[model samples]
Target: NLCSKNKINPLIGSAGVSAVPMAARVSNKVGLESDAQNFLLMHAMGPNVAGVIGSAIAAGVMLKYVLAM
Candidate 1:
């Protein structure tokens, strides 16, 4: 819903799939396809890294909660 509201593809998470620099490279590659000068590797990586961190924290919290049940 948020992505649609902002006109962003909900499938954007694919860029963070591997959590590797290659993912960033792929991001730039995809952007280049749209516009040769458009580079999004660095910018996308910011959120990719943040997502990895957030996912780790979320996983930890879920583990704790599930174990407590």
Candidate 2:
């Protein structure tokens, strides 16, 4: 459950952050439609797979920091 929750949370956050700016710029420049904007947002987030990768990277950094201390 924890992993599932972690996975969803980061993915949502990434998508939200990437999509908001993307939507604004895209809407202003090209007048993209809703579905197209959603697609761009999804692709910009680098997929659900990236969330696990990010988590691993974060854990590695933390581990290194702990060991250094």
Q: What CA root-mean-square deviation does each model show from the true structure?
A: 3.7, 9.8
Question: Which pairs clash (backbone N, Cα, C closer than 3 Å) in model 1?
Answer: none
Model 1 RMSD in Å is 3.7
Residue-level lDDT of model 2, residues 1-69, one tens digit each, is 555645332223434332444533443333234343443444434543465566678899999999999
Task: Compute each candidate's TM-score over C-alphas.
Answer: 0.65, 0.35
Per-model C-alpha lDDT, please?
0.72, 0.47
- Give me candidate 2's TM-score against the actual structure: 0.35
lDDT by residue (1-69, candidate 1, tens digit) is 654556553224656654766777777788788878876777767767877788899899999999999
Q: Say which candidate scores most in TM-score.
A: 1
* Model 2 segments more than 4 A misplaced: 1-46
List candidate 1 stretches off by more than 4 Å.
1-18
For model 2, give the 10-residue run with minimal summed lDDT: 9-18
